[model samples]
Target chain A: MTGGRLAVRKTYKLFIGGAFPRSESGRTLELEGYNVARASRKDAREAVVAARKAFGGWSAATAYNRGQVLYRLAETMETRAGAFAAACTGRREVARAIDRVVWYAGWADKLAQVLGSANPVAGPYFNFTIPEPTGVVAIIAPTEPALDGLVARLAPAVVGGNAVIILASDDHPLAAIELAEAVATSDVPGGVVNVLTGLRSELAPVLAAHMDVNAIDVTGADGDVAALEVLAAENVKRVVRAREDRSPWEIASFMELKTVWHPIGR
Target chain B: MTDLQKRGDRSPVPTDWTYAPAPESTDIVRLQERYGLYVGGEWLETKDQFTTIAPRDESPLAEVGQASEADVQNAVAAAREAFKSWSKLPATERAKYLFRIARILAERSREFAVLESLNGGKPIKESRDVDLPLAAAHFFYYAGWADKLEYAYPNRSPKPLGVAGQIIPWNFPLLMLAWKIAPALACGNTVVLKPAETTPLTALLFADVCRQAEVPPGVVNIVTGDGSTGAHLVRSEGIGKVAFTGSTEVGKAIQRELAGRDISLTLELGGKAANIVFEDCALDQAVEGIVNGIYFNQGHVCCAGSRLLVQESIHDQLVRKLKRRMSTLRVGDPLDKNTDVGAINSKAQLDRITELVQAGTDEGAELYQPPCRLPEKGWWFAPTVFTNVAQSHRIAQEEIFGPVLSVLTFRTPDEAVEKANNTMYGLSAGIWTEKGSRILWMADRLRAGVVWGNTFNRFDPASPFGGYKESGFGREGGRHGLEAYLRFE
Candidate 1:
């Protein structure tokens, strides 16, 4: 060793269908002192296809199973808190992110009771309404407090059984890819959570316009939310902005209420 | 092949069992010669006007004002001005106005029912039994919620969203108005409502009901016109939210126009629902449900079960029974109490249905129209059932919005779910099965907003009603309906 101990740098890549793969475009952008994969529009489209393919089983899974998977996500992150603190944000943010995941995990089984209702409808029918996932939701992760903000959006969405394809913060993309790594090991079935990193301008519009995408969380969208919402309207997508407060309503934003009616007969 | 064999060899409906005309009297409704825009609790005259006609015989009922851009501006200003006091009123005070409106509606139910039939072309049986009562019930329902706003959305303070711009379809004019106005007013939001061009009379009459209930001036405004008027109202400034119940095309346009803006929107759009009848279903009860599912309101309902997906094994028996039952339906005057199906809403809608039915025939599906004599005076379409319909058939995919049913068969429940949900619309679906477990299982799989088991085309104010996917979003009934009008703090 001529001067110092050898240091091996980590390779940052795109996560699709639970696998870390180089951007299909084989593109990379130099950020700070590292090279990060720059996802292409085609990459965003593929992520949507992956998410849609996984939606059935992921959404159909019992809420308790989803809750356990999400809680395991917290456990996985807790073990990697030091790495996330070094790679993304401070230790406090990492701990909060893990705690936030555990918080949403508890909501997985209780969302129906809180959001659903057994109506006293004026009829000879038993009528009730329950919340169901809005299917494949695309999120734009916030730049600051990257891990905390990303988990804030991702946990609520997946807790409601939605398969997600998130666009990580361009400047803070490492934490998201790292979170995807955690997701892969957290028993969140493959493709249920796909992470794409690239120029927000390049990837946000593609995800916004994807027909298979049912709802979009524009919380971290850079000044282009108006444009993104316009594109989202092409498929009548549910457009939601960042909620100022953390609550179950945030989860409800990504869900569709389904009402069922049955004849009350002897 | 003989006509009988072509029709699946159904026995003829006995002519001797004809219903003698038991017509409801039209004298109860007193329509004004000319109606003006109801803005700020007063009738304001406008130069532009259109005649709303009784679709039963093409008779002119009243002259309705065509709200111009300037008129819409006045309505919005009125609603905005009203919102100041209306939103600030004691919640209990607000509740009383709605209770009064509901009471007034029930008191004058007959008049509204006759006018709804005369102006909207739905049967008196429906307007009296279903539409009028439901309309009043919506008011009664939301009235109770006015003071309970704190409990509706947990951990959030609910506040009114100022003025709401609501555009309702002609199919269920008065009821749609109630659906739009009640919760809105209950949530403390003033509304600027535009009734469909063909059916503006009932809404104008509702304006009088508001006055009778002593609702605050400018709290409720009625702007009557066609699509242009609705467009103007939608684009008008001072509207905090837009609630539209119409075709998906218009709903999409509204969405695009509101894009990049801060206004909230909810659309209740079109649907081509599947009414699946399983082999294990009670055949006769399923037959009645099938008929009611498609023929209700002349199939003008957005959630109409226009596509019948029958289990392959029971297809023949169900079709035969459905055909025989359809033959007994009396398609006649909307004012006739015995009329099972009323006149089509308008000539334009009738043409749309005719064109789609022709497409079904051209695409190699067998069409069955019961031998009922359609009246010559106004637009009418015979209750139609198309069998041997392919999943790809236009009639199976499109919302005919008339008395039409397209029948297709499925061998398995998985195939039934696949075929039922293949469409772009997911407003509602019907499952006919005596098996309880299968009903719940199928209900979980059908990608629809509303699922009706062993029954169809049912509605209640306490029950949430809306769609999934392209049929549009935001529920219009029940506690869930409150979300659209209130902004959480």
Candidate 2:
């Protein structure tokens, strides 16, 4: 309009079950001259159902296969780095986010070695501790460093075979939906990465209480950390509050250790 | 109808004469009329007392101090107070203490072995050969890790959590005690241990060993009581961690009780392990393993192979051999050296086994209990196996925690795995096969925590053991076991 040309505009929607869908509640919030999907509790629940349904296949996917899909997502995100930069106010944030996914991609296969090992359990038994994904994880992305923070929460979880349902930043959610657009094209399986753009205050509590959900990463809920933690106890979902460090342990935090002791002898 | 008269398979009676009774003399196991709680490295007065009866004859072996909530609080406080100095001690010094405990356990082996059999109703042979030896081995293994935590999880700075509240089961009292206390002490955490009411004697005896080893006062305390005392300790404030080995029912209540708390928990709960016998397995060895799997510990093992999933091809042959082998199993005095099966742990447990066995018959499954005579004085269950058992049978699904086995058949590897993982409890499994590839393939698919190939009911200190899903979480033993007692930065 500034240059006397017709500018194309996009409508932001929630990512559920591999497709961009309008909120089931048909609610939208007017922010920065854009119609952002004001995701409803029902929408969050649907995403979770879709996520729980997808957990088995995604978690059962080979580590190499998961790493490849994540790498493809990074490639897709890199192509739209400029759009993400504009949404988050910096290109560096988008780059860090891309690098973070790549970093996590390298960790998919190596994590078991770093986190699990065979035990010489002083008998004629062959024992091993294998780290398996801790089912569906509900992630609340922190508001500020929007793009980087979102990637930071998403990568570590799925890298260890866990499926995630991430609630995008309320104001700066355009980048996440754009990332979701790439997720649609990327080999990341449907429902593996479900993103909803909504008020963290409105969505997080319901997700926290969802019994089917295995863990709640509440780094985003700065205001409702205590409430989320208490709500998580309903099903004893593993709760991770604002984490300062980002390592394989973060991946491990969402992984359950399964030790097998088999007797070995004639 | 009588068990023998009602069976589908007419198991050939063992015409051979039974072995002469080889009872281990209880003379060495001297008992006191009353034993108090071992709190702060010394025996203390208790408000109440309960008699711990031997299951072999329902005879009161000793009266143990019944620890109340107040007693549990005192133990936790003692453990918490000891943590400050204990955690500050040099690693080498801590290792020395563990070494001392291990040495003392070895010296008092016979005393512990005899008392273990008398108190827990396990066969004397098992107490001496399996229980006491493994208990001492647990101490020895954890003792080596005292100075080596840094190397164990390289690059990670390992630090001990404060006081650990440990609750052990009746099945392997002192051994479970060693599994809990050794790891906690080695990690620099003090402990408040509650031994099961049925088998509190060996733990009390272990306390004497701890005192003799000169372990710091309040570093290790043994409080004996029933479920309520354990509930108090589980809910008690200021406990850094809780490690429990018991039934799945109690484990869940504890999980719900500790929900949202920062305290760490490691639960070794119930299991309905599937012992899959393949067509290619060494038939004779597999039969011996199968009998040992269920008959050992009177089938009181959490990791006991309660379900026998024999391959359809070898189903008849295996069942005939199993029935014959089970018949030869001498179920009599727990103190008897020749006994293959012992007492059924407690009256309540015996009733449970009886009720389930009745259900198996009521459900139209063929019940084939051996013709061996059980002692009239004690809670006894003959070595029993139920054939033609469906997947829906309660005996097939539930943890009988007794010498009851449900036989099911599978046509393929996938079917075997599907049936094996059908239970809510995934503590352990047994796979008998000659094919190495099949063993690995089946091991990968089975959901159980521990998988035994060609053998069953084997445990070691270095092995990390716990269940998947409701078999409970967190591991006990090995380097992974250390995670339960430590807080990593």
Candidate 3:
């Protein structure tokens, strides 16, 4: 190691179609005084294409399997907490990030319980209710607390089995790229989570109004909330408004409900 | 014959200056106090009655049965009673009813359009074309969801809310009805519907259509009246859920009334949607969106793009194009074939529009109007636009609900998004851009419920639509639309 600092390795790239590559537009931006990867509009479109390819199978995953995968992700994230924390600007954020992963992992099984309930419906046929995830969520990670907030926002969505296209915060994106590496090495299937780091003013609307993005999370978005809300409406994507005081446990807010109805036949 | 006698002999002086179309015996659905509130397969009546008027000339159209507090209670009771069986029906069977309703509406399209125009004061072309077709498509689209609720709410049973009390607005009477009723019915909930008092004709006609479609009685009840009637329906102890589409003021009132009640409510209220035109946008397309945004349906649209935010670089050129396009808009009798804008829905509404337009001028925003004539007897307001409008002006902030546009300009993309989102309402917005990157970027920042790119006010049944923030909550279309009518268990 040079000067007692860990020898840095690997240049992060855009995650698309189960492979990592420099953006098709061949664009890169300087982050933290280093030439880090930046995604192009084409790369964003490719992420969408990959998300579309993965949506059906991923969304079709059984709740139990989804729960298991989420749990596994939490386990993997726990082991790599030091790396994630080191990537972030501080240590408090890393702890919160790990806590967020655990919190969301637990919700994989419990969300259906909270958002779904047995309907005391009027008719004789047995009726029950559940919540379902809106597919292929496109997330604009909160600009601050790049790693923890992003993890908190994205974990619940994926725990609920939503494929995601996350546009990492433009200013501090290394953490996001690192998080993507963590996801890649984990058992999480490719295309289930895509990370694009670029100017949000450049990529958000594409994700928001994208015909394919089923929902969007602007939890970290600061300004122009109304414009993003409107753009997501083009395809009627379910939008999660940004919350300034959101905590790690709040990840459960993104979980989809699924209600199951079984007849009480004698 | 003498000269005077010859003049009299000339077609007897065409006695009735107003055009009179033949009245159809089959189409008339009589309004009466004893009319059964259609709920759960039964017709029940309330003790009260309210008069519905023709906005065309402010004449009494009919005395519609007002839902009593008890009537609301009874209707909700029936709906709740029916929800078990109805909600249990396979999504496919539920969709069949919606599909049938869509077909029936289409088959009776002409009759519905005429009655809609007569009741709501919208132009015949709009009623016949935009409103009716979209209404039919809404039902048809939701009908597909009857079986697909599984897919819609995957891994979960999407149960129906027991009883939904839906109130529709007068602007797009039939279409609003479809927006509320189609989704509710498809989601397998019984509904007590209150059509805006001024526009009850098409809804009553719809009841008849429901009867024809063999939609079991009590599944959908039509209670026609004014705010009092709507308020009573909303406050009734029986309703499990409430959905209202109208002015934001009234939406807040409904919310207040239901505040302590154990009911889920969705309000599709007002919007001052911003239609932003960038310097590089296709000028002709942006101009078309501008006209559609403000002039469509005489600007009574809640999500109408009333605030025109153009880039400063293209402001002059865009305004010139907009003015030229406005000149071509034909404003006249709703019955006329060439009319683009129709009469204001009612006298009160017209007065409000006129008052706001005057305020725009009084505030020093320069007003421009295309040369157009207004009908003397009915409520009418010419298509109007105000330039040099400050972002802080009342005219720019408030929803005028008439064919009025407020013009403001911004210099940068950040400024455009800032100006576009500076509103209490977040219903819908429009962005005109040829650059694909910018389109996506801008869309992500807008907080409105829907964003139209390259087009304005283009609504489809397959797409979900609704507002964010005070523009109201809950969506009205698509798979996402089902959530409004369904319950999560």
Best by DockQ: 1
All candidates in order of TM-score, best leading: 1, 2, 3
Question: DockQ score for model 2, please?
Answer: 0.44
Q: What is the lDDT of residue B262 in candidate 2?
A: 72
Instruction: Give DockQ: model 1.
Output: 0.80
- How badly does each model clash, as a count of residue pairs? 0, 6, 43
Model 1 chain B is weakest, by summed lDDT over 10 consecutive residues, at B1-10
Distance from true position, residue B252, model 2, in Å?
A: 2.2
Instruction: Give me the runs in candidate 2 sitting further than 4 Å from their true place.
Output: A1-9, A23-57, A86-90, A121-126, A140-145, A167-176, A196-244, A260-266, B1-16
Q: Each model's DockQ?
A: 0.80, 0.44, 0.03
Q: What TM-score does each of the candidates earn? A: 0.97, 0.90, 0.66
lDDT tens readout by residue for model 2, B1-489: 112233456764444454756778778777889999888887888999989998888888888888888988998888888889999999889988998998899888988998888888899899899988888888888889989999876766889989999999999988999999999999999999999979999988888888888999999999899998899999999798989899877776676677667788777888999999999999999999998898898998999989999989999999999888887888888888988788888999989999999999999899998787778998998888899999998999999999899999998999999999887777888889888788888887787777888888888787778776667777888787887888777
lDDT of 3 by residue, A132-219 (tens): 4556788889877878878877887788767889888888888888788778877778999998987888888778767777667877
Candidate 2 or 1, higher lDDT: 1
- Report how closely model 3 matches the true complex, as a DockQ value: 0.03
lDDT digits (tens) for residues B1-489 of candidate 3: 122223644553543443333223324434443344555565555577666666656667666677666666676777677677777777677788888999999998888877787778788888888889989988988888777777766655677777888898888888989999888888788888888877877887787888888887678878776787788888777677899998877876676566334477777889999988889987897798899989999999988999999989889888998999999888876766566887788888888988998989999999999987676777888899999999888899999999999999999999989898888787888878777567656765676767667667766675557776567667676565688887654
Best candidate according to lDDT: 1
**Global lDDT scores for all candidate models:** 0.92, 0.85, 0.75
Error of 2 at A114 (Å): 2.0
- Estimate the Cα RMSD of every predicted model relative to the unseen true structure: 4.6, 5.3, 14.1
